[model samples]
Target: MTSAALPPSASVTVRVPAKINLELLVGPPGADGYHPLATVFHAVNLFDEVTVTAAEEWGLSVSGPQSLGVPVDGTNLAAKAAQALAERAGVDEPVHIAIRKDIPVAGGMAGGSADAAATLVACDHLWGLGTTKQELEEIAGGLGSDVAFLLSGGTAMGSGRGEILAPVLARGTYHWVLALSEGGLSTPAVYAECDRLRGSVAVPDPVPTPEMMQALRSGDARALGAALQNDLQAAALSLMPALTDVIDAGLEFGAVGGIVSGSGPTVAFLCEDTESALDLAVALTASGAVQDVRRATGPAHGAHVIGGPRPG
Candidate 1:
Protein backbone atom coordinates (compact mmCIF):
# COMPACT_ATOMS: atom_id res chain seq x y z
CA MET A 1 0.00 0.00 0.00
CA THR A 2 3.02 2.28 0.34
CA SER A 3 3.63 2.09 -3.40
CA ALA A 4 0.92 4.53 -4.37
CA ALA A 5 3.30 6.26 -6.75
CA LEU A 6 3.83 3.25 -8.99
CA PRO A 7 2.99 3.58 -12.65
CA PRO A 8 -0.45 2.39 -13.82
CA SER A 9 1.14 -0.40 -15.84
CA ALA A 10 2.91 -1.94 -12.85
CA SER A 11 2.09 -5.40 -11.53
CA VAL A 12 2.10 -6.77 -7.98
CA THR A 13 2.20 -10.24 -6.48
CA VAL A 14 0.93 -11.40 -3.09
CA ARG A 15 1.36 -14.77 -1.38
CA VAL A 16 -1.27 -16.07 1.01
CA PRO A 17 -1.19 -19.16 3.23
CA ALA A 18 -3.86 -21.83 3.76
CA LYS A 19 -5.80 -22.11 7.03
CA ILE A 20 -6.78 -25.00 9.31
CA ASN A 21 -9.41 -24.87 11.99
CA LEU A 22 -7.64 -26.38 14.97
CA GLU A 23 -10.82 -26.22 17.05
CA LEU A 24 -14.07 -25.53 15.20
CA LEU A 25 -17.04 -25.04 17.49
CA VAL A 26 -20.24 -24.62 15.50
CA GLY A 27 -23.44 -23.17 16.91
CA PRO A 28 -26.99 -23.40 15.61
CA PRO A 29 -27.47 -21.73 12.28
CA GLY A 30 -28.59 -18.16 12.67
CA ALA A 31 -31.31 -16.43 10.68
CA ASP A 32 -28.86 -15.85 7.83
CA GLY A 33 -28.22 -19.60 7.46
CA TYR A 34 -24.62 -19.00 8.54
CA HIS A 35 -23.31 -20.83 11.57
CA PRO A 36 -21.82 -18.89 14.46
CA LEU A 37 -18.32 -20.19 15.10
CA ALA A 38 -15.99 -19.91 18.06
CA THR A 39 -12.91 -21.45 16.58
CA VAL A 40 -9.11 -21.41 16.54
CA PHE A 41 -7.59 -20.75 13.13
CA HIS A 42 -4.00 -21.75 12.33
CA ALA A 43 -2.24 -20.78 9.15
CA VAL A 44 0.08 -23.35 7.59
CA ASN A 45 2.75 -23.54 4.87
CA LEU A 46 0.32 -24.50 2.12
CA PHE A 47 -0.08 -21.39 -0.03
CA ASP A 48 -1.55 -19.84 -3.16
CA GLU A 49 0.06 -16.80 -4.79
CA VAL A 50 -1.93 -14.27 -6.80
CA THR A 51 -0.52 -11.60 -9.08
CA VAL A 52 -2.32 -8.67 -10.65
CA THR A 53 -1.47 -6.56 -13.66
CA ALA A 54 -3.29 -3.86 -15.57
CA ALA A 55 -4.96 -5.17 -18.68
CA GLU A 56 -7.20 -3.94 -21.50
CA GLU A 57 -9.92 -6.24 -20.13
CA TRP A 58 -10.44 -8.42 -17.11
CA GLY A 59 -8.83 -11.85 -17.33
CA LEU A 60 -7.77 -14.73 -15.11
CA SER A 61 -5.42 -17.70 -15.46
CA VAL A 62 -4.39 -20.41 -13.05
CA SER A 63 -1.53 -22.89 -12.81
CA GLY A 64 0.16 -25.28 -10.38
CA PRO A 65 -0.15 -28.91 -9.27
CA GLN A 66 -3.48 -28.20 -7.64
CA SER A 67 -4.78 -26.14 -10.57
CA LEU A 68 -6.58 -28.87 -12.50
CA GLY A 69 -10.13 -28.24 -11.23
CA VAL A 70 -9.97 -24.55 -10.30
CA PRO A 71 -12.23 -22.21 -12.24
CA VAL A 72 -10.79 -19.55 -14.52
CA ASP A 73 -14.02 -17.58 -14.90
CA GLY A 74 -15.91 -14.83 -13.09
CA THR A 75 -17.45 -17.41 -10.77
CA ASN A 76 -14.09 -17.77 -9.08
CA LEU A 77 -13.81 -15.97 -5.76
CA ALA A 78 -10.63 -14.18 -6.83
CA ALA A 79 -12.48 -12.71 -9.78
CA LYS A 80 -15.33 -11.63 -7.51
CA ALA A 81 -12.75 -10.03 -5.23
CA ALA A 82 -11.33 -7.91 -8.03
CA GLN A 83 -14.81 -6.79 -9.04
CA ALA A 84 -15.68 -5.91 -5.43
CA LEU A 85 -12.52 -3.88 -4.91
CA ALA A 86 -12.94 -2.05 -8.22
CA GLU A 87 -16.46 -1.02 -7.24
CA ARG A 88 -15.44 -0.07 -3.71
CA ALA A 89 -12.56 2.09 -4.93
CA GLY A 90 -14.59 3.61 -7.76
CA VAL A 91 -12.04 2.46 -10.33
CA ASP A 92 -13.02 0.73 -13.56
CA GLU A 93 -9.62 -0.24 -14.93
CA PRO A 94 -9.47 -3.95 -15.69
CA VAL A 95 -6.89 -6.28 -14.19
CA HIS A 96 -5.50 -9.63 -15.28
CA ILE A 97 -5.13 -11.91 -12.26
CA ALA A 98 -2.79 -14.89 -12.24
CA ILE A 99 -3.32 -17.42 -9.47
CA ARG A 100 -0.78 -20.12 -8.74
CA LYS A 101 -2.54 -22.61 -6.56
CA ASP A 102 -0.75 -24.74 -3.98
CA ILE A 103 -3.52 -25.15 -1.45
CA PRO A 104 -5.87 -28.06 -2.05
CA VAL A 105 -9.07 -26.98 -3.77
CA ALA A 106 -12.34 -27.61 -1.94
CA GLY A 107 -10.59 -29.53 0.77
CA GLY A 108 -12.26 -27.38 3.41
CA MET A 109 -8.90 -25.65 3.77
CA ALA A 110 -10.22 -22.34 2.40
CA GLY A 111 -7.95 -22.16 -0.66
CA GLY A 112 -10.47 -20.02 -2.57
CA SER A 113 -10.66 -17.58 0.33
CA ALA A 114 -6.86 -17.31 0.35
CA ASP A 115 -6.84 -16.36 -3.31
CA ALA A 116 -9.49 -13.68 -2.72
CA ALA A 117 -7.47 -12.20 0.12
CA ALA A 118 -4.34 -12.23 -2.02
CA THR A 119 -6.22 -10.53 -4.86
CA LEU A 120 -7.31 -7.70 -2.57
CA VAL A 121 -3.73 -7.05 -1.48
CA ALA A 122 -2.30 -7.44 -4.97
CA CYS A 123 -4.94 -5.26 -6.64
CA ASP A 124 -4.69 -2.62 -3.94
CA HIS A 125 -0.97 -2.20 -4.55
CA LEU A 126 -1.15 -2.75 -8.31
CA TRP A 127 -3.77 -0.04 -8.61
CA GLY A 128 -1.93 2.29 -6.22
CA LEU A 129 -5.19 2.81 -4.34
CA GLY A 130 -3.49 3.02 -0.91
CA THR A 131 -6.46 1.32 0.75
CA THR A 132 -6.26 1.15 4.55
CA LYS A 133 -6.04 -2.12 6.49
CA GLN A 134 -9.40 -1.49 8.14
CA GLU A 135 -11.03 -1.01 4.76
CA LEU A 136 -9.41 -4.19 3.47
CA GLU A 137 -10.69 -6.09 6.49
CA GLU A 138 -14.20 -4.80 5.89
CA ILE A 139 -14.06 -5.89 2.25
CA ALA A 140 -12.59 -9.25 3.23
CA GLY A 141 -15.35 -9.88 5.73
CA GLY A 142 -17.89 -9.49 2.95
CA LEU A 143 -16.01 -11.78 0.56
CA GLY A 144 -16.03 -14.86 2.81
CA SER A 145 -15.67 -16.02 6.38
CA ASP A 146 -12.06 -17.20 6.04
CA VAL A 147 -10.90 -14.29 3.85
CA ALA A 148 -10.16 -11.97 6.78
CA PHE A 149 -8.04 -14.59 8.56
CA LEU A 150 -6.05 -15.17 5.37
CA LEU A 151 -5.29 -11.45 5.45
CA SER A 152 -3.87 -11.66 9.01
CA GLY A 153 -2.71 -15.24 9.50
CA GLY A 154 -1.00 -17.08 12.35
CA THR A 155 -3.28 -17.97 15.27
CA ALA A 156 -6.59 -16.15 15.74
CA MET A 157 -9.99 -16.52 17.32
CA GLY A 158 -12.64 -16.67 14.60
CA SER A 159 -16.13 -15.50 15.53
CA GLY A 160 -19.25 -14.19 13.76
CA ARG A 161 -19.38 -16.73 10.99
CA GLY A 162 -15.53 -16.84 11.07
CA GLU A 163 -15.15 -13.35 9.63
CA ILE A 164 -14.43 -11.34 12.80
CA LEU A 165 -10.96 -12.16 14.12
CA ALA A 166 -8.62 -11.45 17.05
CA PRO A 167 -5.02 -12.59 17.37
CA VAL A 168 -4.18 -15.49 19.67
CA LEU A 169 -0.81 -15.94 21.38
CA ALA A 170 0.57 -19.19 20.03
CA ARG A 171 4.08 -19.80 21.45
CA GLY A 172 5.74 -22.30 19.09
CA THR A 173 5.69 -23.74 15.64
CA TYR A 174 3.59 -26.89 15.16
CA HIS A 175 4.29 -29.58 12.58
CA TRP A 176 1.37 -31.11 10.69
CA VAL A 177 0.79 -34.04 8.36
CA LEU A 178 -2.04 -33.33 5.95
CA ALA A 179 -3.64 -36.38 4.37
CA LEU A 180 -5.15 -35.36 1.09
CA SER A 181 -8.00 -37.19 -0.57
CA GLU A 182 -8.70 -37.97 -4.22
CA GLY A 183 -11.85 -35.80 -4.35
CA GLY A 184 -12.88 -32.57 -2.70
CA LEU A 185 -15.73 -32.04 -0.27
CA SER A 186 -18.40 -29.44 -0.92
CA THR A 187 -18.55 -27.11 2.07
CA PRO A 188 -22.23 -26.34 1.62
CA ALA A 189 -23.07 -30.00 1.32
CA VAL A 190 -21.19 -30.73 4.52
CA TYR A 191 -23.06 -27.99 6.40
CA ALA A 192 -26.37 -29.26 5.10
CA GLU A 193 -25.41 -32.73 6.20
CA CYS A 194 -24.54 -31.34 9.64
CA ASP A 195 -28.00 -29.84 10.00
CA ARG A 196 -29.60 -33.06 8.84
CA LEU A 197 -27.64 -35.10 11.34
CA ARG A 198 -28.60 -32.76 14.17
CA GLY A 199 -32.30 -33.27 13.32
CA SER A 200 -34.00 -30.78 15.64
CA VAL A 201 -31.47 -31.22 18.42
CA ALA A 202 -30.78 -27.97 20.21
CA VAL A 203 -27.45 -26.78 18.81
CA PRO A 204 -26.39 -24.20 21.34
CA ASP A 205 -23.85 -21.42 21.08
CA PRO A 206 -20.18 -22.18 20.66
CA VAL A 207 -17.76 -21.23 23.44
CA PRO A 208 -14.03 -21.04 24.09
CA THR A 209 -11.73 -23.94 24.79
CA PRO A 210 -9.45 -22.66 27.54
CA GLU A 211 -7.30 -25.81 27.46
CA MET A 212 -6.65 -25.42 23.75
CA MET A 213 -5.70 -21.76 24.23
CA GLN A 214 -3.48 -22.61 27.18
CA ALA A 215 -1.75 -25.35 25.20
CA LEU A 216 -1.06 -22.93 22.38
CA ARG A 217 0.30 -20.38 24.82
CA SER A 218 2.62 -23.01 26.32
CA GLY A 219 3.60 -24.47 22.92
CA ASP A 220 2.62 -27.94 24.01
CA ALA A 221 1.81 -30.01 20.93
CA ARG A 222 0.49 -32.96 22.93
CA ALA A 223 -1.95 -30.87 24.90
CA LEU A 224 -3.04 -29.06 21.78
CA GLY A 225 -3.52 -32.32 19.92
CA ALA A 226 -5.55 -33.82 22.72
CA ALA A 227 -7.80 -30.77 22.68
CA LEU A 228 -8.43 -30.67 18.92
CA GLN A 229 -12.20 -30.68 18.28
CA ASN A 230 -14.53 -30.03 15.36
CA ASP A 231 -18.32 -30.04 15.35
CA LEU A 232 -18.39 -30.46 11.58
CA GLN A 233 -16.26 -33.57 12.01
CA ALA A 234 -19.25 -35.81 12.51
CA ALA A 235 -20.92 -34.41 9.42
CA ALA A 236 -17.73 -34.57 7.38
CA LEU A 237 -17.28 -38.16 8.43
CA SER A 238 -20.88 -38.92 7.60
CA LEU A 239 -20.56 -37.53 4.10
CA MET A 240 -17.18 -39.13 3.44
CA PRO A 241 -16.85 -42.17 5.61
CA ALA A 242 -13.61 -43.12 3.89
CA LEU A 243 -11.97 -40.26 5.79
CA THR A 244 -12.31 -42.20 9.01
CA ASP A 245 -9.71 -44.68 7.81
CA VAL A 246 -7.32 -41.85 7.10
CA ILE A 247 -7.79 -40.40 10.59
CA ASP A 248 -7.30 -43.81 12.16
CA ALA A 249 -4.09 -44.31 10.20
CA GLY A 250 -2.69 -41.02 11.48
CA LEU A 251 -3.40 -41.90 15.08
CA GLU A 252 -2.10 -45.41 14.55
CA PHE A 253 1.12 -43.90 13.20
CA GLY A 254 1.51 -42.28 16.61
CA ALA A 255 0.46 -38.74 15.81
CA VAL A 256 -0.17 -36.77 18.99
CA GLY A 257 -3.57 -35.77 17.63
CA GLY A 258 -5.58 -35.94 14.42
CA ILE A 259 -8.76 -34.28 13.17
CA VAL A 260 -10.56 -33.61 9.92
CA SER A 261 -9.20 -30.24 8.82
CA GLY A 262 -12.05 -27.78 8.64
CA SER A 263 -14.98 -29.40 6.77
CA GLY A 264 -12.61 -31.91 5.41
CA PRO A 265 -11.63 -34.84 3.38
CA THR A 266 -8.15 -33.56 4.26
CA VAL A 267 -7.23 -34.96 7.66
CA ALA A 268 -4.67 -32.98 9.66
CA PHE A 269 -2.42 -34.75 12.13
CA LEU A 270 -0.68 -32.77 14.84
CA CYS A 271 2.78 -34.13 15.35
CA GLU A 272 5.40 -33.59 18.02
CA ASP A 273 8.02 -32.28 15.60
CA THR A 274 9.26 -32.21 12.02
CA GLU A 275 10.55 -35.75 12.21
CA SER A 276 7.28 -36.97 13.58
CA ALA A 277 5.37 -35.26 10.80
CA LEU A 278 7.50 -36.85 8.10
CA ASP A 279 7.12 -40.25 9.63
CA LEU A 280 3.37 -39.91 9.97
CA ALA A 281 3.04 -38.65 6.43
CA VAL A 282 4.91 -41.65 5.09
CA ALA A 283 2.84 -44.02 7.16
CA LEU A 284 -0.44 -42.52 5.99
CA THR A 285 0.64 -42.71 2.36
CA ALA A 286 1.81 -46.28 2.75
CA SER A 287 -1.50 -47.18 4.31
CA GLY A 288 -3.10 -46.36 0.97
CA ALA A 289 -5.97 -44.66 2.73
CA VAL A 290 -5.03 -41.20 1.47
CA GLN A 291 -4.37 -39.94 -2.03
CA ASP A 292 -1.34 -37.91 -0.87
CA VAL A 293 0.34 -36.41 2.16
CA ARG A 294 1.95 -33.05 2.77
CA ARG A 295 4.15 -32.16 5.70
CA ALA A 296 3.56 -28.57 6.80
CA THR A 297 4.40 -26.28 9.70
CA GLY A 298 1.90 -23.91 11.24
CA PRO A 299 1.79 -20.27 12.45
CA ALA A 300 2.74 -18.97 8.98
CA HIS A 301 2.37 -15.32 8.14
CA GLY A 302 -0.71 -14.04 6.30
CA ALA A 303 -1.09 -12.50 2.87
CA HIS A 304 1.19 -9.63 1.81
CA VAL A 305 3.07 -8.37 -1.18
CA ILE A 306 5.93 -10.61 -2.21
CA GLY A 307 6.58 -8.53 -5.31
CA GLY A 308 6.47 -4.76 -5.33
CA PRO A 309 5.03 -2.85 -8.21
CA ARG A 310 7.27 -2.98 -11.30
CA PRO A 311 6.82 -1.13 -14.54
CA GLY A 312 5.63 -3.34 -17.39
Candidate 2:
Protein backbone atom coordinates (compact mmCIF):
# COMPACT_ATOMS: atom_id res chain seq x y z
CA MET A 1 0.00 0.00 0.00
CA THR A 2 2.99 2.31 0.42
CA SER A 3 3.47 2.68 -3.34
CA ALA A 4 0.10 1.62 -4.76
CA ALA A 5 -2.06 4.38 -6.30
CA LEU A 6 -0.24 7.11 -4.27
CA PRO A 7 -3.02 6.92 -1.59
CA PRO A 8 -5.26 9.27 -3.62
CA SER A 9 -3.49 12.43 -2.39
CA ALA A 10 -5.97 12.75 0.44
CA SER A 11 -6.36 15.31 3.20
CA VAL A 12 -6.15 14.29 6.85
CA THR A 13 -7.02 16.26 9.99
CA VAL A 14 -5.65 15.26 13.39
CA ARG A 15 -6.99 16.48 16.72
CA VAL A 16 -4.18 17.12 19.20
CA PRO A 17 -4.66 17.52 22.93
CA ALA A 18 -2.98 20.02 25.22
CA LYS A 19 -1.06 18.67 28.24
CA ILE A 20 -1.03 19.57 31.92
CA ASN A 21 1.84 18.94 34.28
CA LEU A 22 0.12 17.49 37.33
CA GLU A 23 3.40 17.66 39.14
CA LEU A 24 6.28 19.75 37.74
CA LEU A 25 9.61 19.83 39.53
CA VAL A 26 12.51 21.91 38.31
CA GLY A 27 16.04 21.01 39.30
CA PRO A 28 19.35 22.80 38.72
CA PRO A 29 19.91 24.23 35.26
CA GLY A 30 22.04 21.92 33.13
CA ALA A 31 25.14 22.87 31.20
CA ASP A 32 22.71 23.64 28.38
CA GLY A 33 20.90 25.99 30.86
CA TYR A 34 17.68 23.99 30.57
CA HIS A 35 16.70 22.71 33.98
CA PRO A 36 16.22 19.04 34.65
CA LEU A 37 12.59 18.23 35.50
CA ALA A 38 10.40 15.50 36.88
CA THR A 39 6.82 15.96 35.80
CA VAL A 40 3.63 13.95 35.43
CA PHE A 41 1.92 15.02 32.24
CA HIS A 42 -1.75 14.42 31.51
CA ALA A 43 -3.34 14.95 28.10
CA VAL A 44 -6.43 17.12 28.37
CA ASN A 45 -9.42 17.45 26.06
CA LEU A 46 -8.55 20.98 25.00
CA PHE A 47 -7.10 20.57 21.52
CA ASP A 48 -5.65 22.16 18.40
CA GLU A 49 -6.59 20.82 14.98
CA VAL A 50 -4.01 20.04 12.28
CA THR A 51 -4.83 19.20 8.67
CA VAL A 52 -2.42 18.03 6.00
CA THR A 53 -2.79 17.84 2.21
CA ALA A 54 -0.48 16.97 -0.64
CA ALA A 55 1.05 19.89 -2.50
CA GLU A 56 3.74 20.62 -5.08
CA GLU A 57 6.18 22.15 -2.59
CA TRP A 58 6.49 21.82 1.18
CA GLY A 59 4.70 24.68 2.90
CA LEU A 60 2.50 25.49 5.92
CA SER A 61 -0.58 27.70 6.08
CA VAL A 62 -1.80 28.37 9.59
CA SER A 63 -5.35 29.49 10.52
CA GLY A 64 -7.83 29.09 13.33
CA PRO A 65 -9.05 30.95 16.39
CA GLN A 66 -5.52 31.84 17.46
CA SER A 67 -3.80 31.45 14.08
CA LEU A 68 -2.76 35.07 13.78
CA GLY A 69 0.12 34.51 16.21
CA VAL A 70 1.24 31.20 14.71
CA PRO A 71 4.29 31.30 12.43
CA VAL A 72 3.69 29.49 9.14
CA ASP A 73 6.63 30.02 6.76
CA GLY A 74 8.60 26.86 7.60
CA THR A 75 9.21 27.92 11.19
CA ASN A 76 6.16 26.13 12.53
CA LEU A 77 6.65 22.80 14.28
CA ALA A 78 4.33 21.14 11.76
CA ALA A 79 6.44 22.41 8.90
CA LYS A 80 9.52 21.04 10.59
CA ALA A 81 7.85 17.63 10.96
CA ALA A 82 6.94 17.57 7.28
CA GLN A 83 10.46 18.49 6.20
CA ALA A 84 11.99 15.91 8.52
CA LEU A 85 9.61 13.15 7.48
CA ALA A 86 9.88 13.86 3.77
CA GLU A 87 13.66 13.81 3.97
CA ARG A 88 13.62 10.57 5.93
CA ALA A 89 11.08 8.94 3.60
CA GLY A 90 12.89 10.25 0.53
CA VAL A 91 9.76 11.81 -1.01
CA ASP A 92 10.01 14.93 -3.15
CA GLU A 93 6.37 16.06 -3.09
CA PRO A 94 5.77 18.77 -0.53
CA VAL A 95 2.97 18.46 2.05
CA HIS A 96 0.64 21.34 2.75
CA ILE A 97 -0.47 21.67 6.40
CA ALA A 98 -3.20 23.82 7.91
CA ILE A 99 -3.21 24.21 11.68
CA ARG A 100 -6.30 25.29 13.59
CA LYS A 101 -5.15 26.45 17.00
CA ASP A 102 -7.73 25.89 19.73
CA ILE A 103 -5.32 25.35 22.55
CA PRO A 104 -3.91 28.67 23.71
CA VAL A 105 -0.34 29.40 22.62
CA ALA A 106 2.37 29.65 25.25
CA GLY A 107 -0.21 28.60 27.80
CA GLY A 108 2.08 25.86 29.12
CA MET A 109 -0.11 23.35 27.31
CA ALA A 110 2.28 22.01 24.69
CA GLY A 111 0.35 23.60 21.78
CA GLY A 112 3.23 23.76 19.32
CA SER A 113 4.55 20.35 20.25
CA ALA A 114 1.09 18.89 19.89
CA ASP A 115 0.84 20.35 16.40
CA ALA A 116 4.14 18.74 15.49
CA ALA A 117 2.97 15.38 16.86
CA ALA A 118 -0.30 15.60 14.92
CA THR A 119 1.47 16.38 11.68
CA LEU A 120 3.87 13.46 12.12
CA VAL A 121 1.02 10.99 12.62
CA ALA A 122 -1.33 12.43 9.96
CA CYS A 123 1.35 12.75 7.33
CA ASP A 124 2.54 9.22 8.00
CA HIS A 125 -0.82 8.01 6.77
CA LEU A 126 -1.42 10.74 4.19
CA TRP A 127 1.92 10.14 2.53
CA GLY A 128 1.80 6.35 3.00
CA LEU A 129 5.18 6.29 4.72
CA GLY A 130 4.17 3.42 7.05
CA THR A 131 6.06 4.62 10.08
CA THR A 132 5.44 2.85 13.39
CA LYS A 133 4.39 4.60 16.61
CA GLN A 134 7.81 4.07 18.16
CA GLU A 135 9.52 5.53 15.12
CA LEU A 136 7.21 8.54 15.18
CA GLU A 137 7.84 9.11 18.88
CA GLU A 138 11.57 9.24 18.17
CA ILE A 139 10.89 12.13 15.79
CA ALA A 140 8.46 13.78 18.22
CA GLY A 141 11.05 13.89 21.02
CA GLY A 142 13.45 15.89 18.85
CA LEU A 143 10.77 18.58 18.37
CA GLY A 144 10.28 19.57 22.02
CA SER A 145 10.39 18.53 25.65
CA ASP A 146 6.66 17.73 25.77
CA VAL A 147 6.29 16.27 22.28
CA ALA A 148 6.47 12.65 23.42
CA PHE A 149 3.40 13.13 25.64
CA LEU A 150 1.46 14.07 22.52
CA LEU A 151 2.37 10.70 21.08
CA SER A 152 1.62 8.69 24.23
CA GLY A 153 -1.44 10.83 25.04
CA GLY A 154 -1.90 9.80 28.64
CA THR A 155 -0.34 10.06 32.04
CA ALA A 156 3.43 9.65 32.12
CA MET A 157 6.43 10.63 34.21
CA GLY A 158 8.87 12.77 32.24
CA SER A 159 12.48 13.39 33.24
CA GLY A 160 15.69 14.40 31.49
CA ARG A 161 14.72 17.82 30.17
CA GLY A 162 11.22 16.30 30.14
CA GLU A 163 11.69 13.93 27.18
CA ILE A 164 12.12 10.51 28.83
CA LEU A 165 8.75 8.88 29.59
CA ALA A 166 7.28 6.14 31.82
CA PRO A 167 3.50 5.76 31.68
CA VAL A 168 1.44 6.04 34.87
CA LEU A 169 -2.09 4.82 35.51
CA ALA A 170 -4.51 7.61 36.29
CA ARG A 171 -8.03 6.33 36.83
CA GLY A 172 -11.18 8.36 36.00
CA THR A 173 -11.26 11.62 34.14
CA TYR A 174 -10.40 14.71 36.16
CA HIS A 175 -12.64 17.68 35.43
CA TRP A 176 -10.94 21.04 35.01
CA VAL A 177 -11.80 24.69 34.42
CA LEU A 178 -9.14 26.53 32.44
CA ALA A 179 -8.82 30.31 32.54
CA LEU A 180 -7.31 31.51 29.27
CA SER A 181 -4.79 34.34 29.29
CA GLU A 182 -4.91 37.33 26.92
CA GLY A 183 -1.58 36.40 25.28
CA GLY A 184 1.29 33.92 25.37
CA LEU A 185 4.21 33.54 27.77
CA SER A 186 7.61 32.18 26.84
CA THR A 187 8.60 28.88 28.47
CA PRO A 188 12.23 29.81 28.90
CA ALA A 189 11.21 33.16 30.29
CA VAL A 190 9.02 31.49 32.85
CA TYR A 191 11.90 29.29 33.98
CA ALA A 192 14.15 32.30 34.09
CA GLU A 193 11.52 34.08 36.12
CA CYS A 194 11.55 31.17 38.55
CA ASP A 195 15.30 31.49 38.82
CA ARG A 196 14.97 35.22 39.36
CA LEU A 197 12.32 34.81 42.03
CA ARG A 198 14.35 32.13 43.74
CA GLY A 199 17.49 34.25 43.37
CA SER A 200 21.01 33.36 42.18
CA VAL A 201 20.86 29.58 42.73
CA ALA A 202 18.53 26.71 43.64
CA VAL A 203 18.65 23.13 44.84
CA PRO A 204 16.81 20.06 43.58
CA ASP A 205 14.21 18.43 45.77
CA PRO A 206 15.06 15.00 47.24
CA VAL A 207 13.17 13.12 44.53
CA PRO A 208 9.71 12.56 43.08
CA THR A 209 7.31 12.26 45.99
CA PRO A 210 6.04 8.79 46.77
CA GLU A 211 2.71 10.32 47.76
CA MET A 212 2.28 12.08 44.40
CA MET A 213 2.93 8.89 42.47
CA GLN A 214 0.64 6.92 44.75
CA ALA A 215 -2.18 9.46 44.42
CA LEU A 216 -2.15 9.10 40.65
CA ARG A 217 -2.36 5.34 40.92
CA SER A 218 -5.17 5.56 43.47
CA GLY A 219 -7.10 7.87 41.09
CA ASP A 220 -8.97 9.92 43.65
CA ALA A 221 -9.86 13.41 42.54
CA ARG A 222 -9.31 14.99 45.92
CA ALA A 223 -6.04 13.16 46.36
CA LEU A 224 -4.91 14.17 42.92
CA GLY A 225 -6.02 17.75 43.55
CA ALA A 226 -4.03 17.93 46.75
CA ALA A 227 -1.00 16.57 44.95
CA LEU A 228 -1.18 19.05 42.07
CA GLN A 229 1.87 21.17 42.67
CA ASN A 230 4.15 22.80 40.12
CA ASP A 231 7.61 23.88 41.24
CA LEU A 232 7.29 26.55 38.57
CA GLN A 233 4.08 27.91 40.11
CA ALA A 234 5.98 30.21 42.43
CA ALA A 235 7.97 31.61 39.53
CA ALA A 236 4.87 31.95 37.39
CA LEU A 237 3.02 33.68 40.20
CA SER A 238 5.95 35.98 40.83
CA LEU A 239 6.27 36.89 37.15
CA MET A 240 2.54 37.57 36.72
CA PRO A 241 0.97 38.54 40.00
CA ALA A 242 -2.44 38.81 38.38
CA LEU A 243 -2.53 35.03 38.20
CA THR A 244 -3.01 35.10 41.96
CA ASP A 245 -6.58 36.27 41.54
CA VAL A 246 -7.21 33.68 38.86
CA ILE A 247 -5.99 30.96 41.20
CA ASP A 248 -7.91 32.39 44.15
CA ALA A 249 -11.19 32.82 42.28
CA GLY A 250 -11.09 29.28 41.01
CA LEU A 251 -10.80 27.91 44.52
CA GLU A 252 -13.34 30.42 45.87
CA PHE A 253 -15.87 28.99 43.44
CA GLY A 254 -15.41 25.46 44.87
CA ALA A 255 -12.54 24.30 42.73
CA VAL A 256 -10.54 21.77 44.71
CA GLY A 257 -7.24 23.41 43.76
CA GLY A 258 -5.78 25.71 41.14
CA ILE A 259 -2.39 26.36 39.60
CA VAL A 260 -0.81 28.09 36.63
CA SER A 261 -0.83 25.76 33.65
CA GLY A 262 2.61 24.79 32.33
CA SER A 263 4.31 28.20 32.60
CA GLY A 264 1.77 30.94 32.76
CA PRO A 265 -0.59 32.68 32.71
CA THR A 266 -3.30 30.18 31.89
CA VAL A 267 -4.79 28.85 35.15
CA ALA A 268 -6.34 25.41 35.59
CA PHE A 269 -8.72 24.39 38.37
CA LEU A 270 -9.54 20.92 39.53
CA CYS A 271 -13.22 20.28 40.14
CA GLU A 272 -15.31 17.44 41.51
CA ASP A 273 -17.43 16.83 38.45
CA THR A 274 -18.45 18.20 35.07
CA GLU A 275 -21.14 20.35 36.69
CA SER A 276 -18.71 21.71 39.25
CA ALA A 277 -16.24 22.43 36.47
CA LEU A 278 -18.88 24.44 34.62
CA ASP A 279 -19.93 26.32 37.74
CA LEU A 280 -16.31 27.10 38.57
CA ALA A 281 -15.74 28.32 35.03
CA VAL A 282 -18.75 30.62 35.27
CA ALA A 283 -17.74 32.00 38.62
CA LEU A 284 -14.15 32.50 37.56
CA THR A 285 -15.30 34.29 34.42
CA ALA A 286 -17.43 36.63 36.52
CA SER A 287 -14.39 37.34 38.68
CA GLY A 288 -12.59 38.68 35.57
CA ALA A 289 -9.29 36.97 36.40
CA VAL A 290 -8.81 36.00 32.76
CA GLN A 291 -9.95 36.51 29.18
CA ASP A 292 -12.14 33.38 28.93
CA VAL A 293 -12.80 30.02 30.53
CA ARG A 294 -12.93 26.49 29.11
CA ARG A 295 -13.98 23.27 30.87
CA ALA A 296 -12.14 20.05 30.04
CA THR A 297 -11.26 16.54 31.19
CA GLY A 298 -7.85 15.04 31.80
CA PRO A 299 -6.10 11.97 30.24
CA ALA A 300 -7.52 12.43 26.73
CA HIS A 301 -5.96 10.79 23.70
CA GLY A 302 -3.32 12.41 21.49
CA ALA A 303 -3.61 13.60 17.88
CA HIS A 304 -5.34 11.45 15.26
CA VAL A 305 -6.76 12.10 11.78
CA ILE A 306 -10.40 13.00 11.19
CA GLY A 307 -12.25 11.26 8.37
CA GLY A 308 -13.53 14.38 6.62
CA PRO A 309 -11.88 17.71 6.07
CA ARG A 310 -10.36 19.49 3.11
CA PRO A 311 -8.13 22.50 2.61
CA GLY A 312 -8.75 24.34 -0.70
* Overall local distance difference test of candidate 2: 0.82
The models' CA-based lDDT, in order, is 0.90, 0.82
Instruction: List runs of model 1 lying over 4 Å from the truth.
Output: 1-9, 310-312
Question: Residue-wise lDDT of candidate 1 within 87-199, one digit each (tens)?
Answer: 99988778899999999999989999999999999988787788888899999999999999999899999999899898888899999999999889999999999999999
Q: Runs in model 2 with CA error above 4 Å?
A: 1-9, 308-312
**Model 2 misses residue 293 by how many Å?**
0.2
lDDT string, candidate 2, 102-139, tens digits: 88888888899999999988788777777877878778
Q: Name the best candidate (by lDDT).
A: 1
Clashing pairs in 1: none
Candidate 1, residue 195: the lDDT equals 94
Residue 287, model 2, lDDT: 81
Clashes of 2: 0
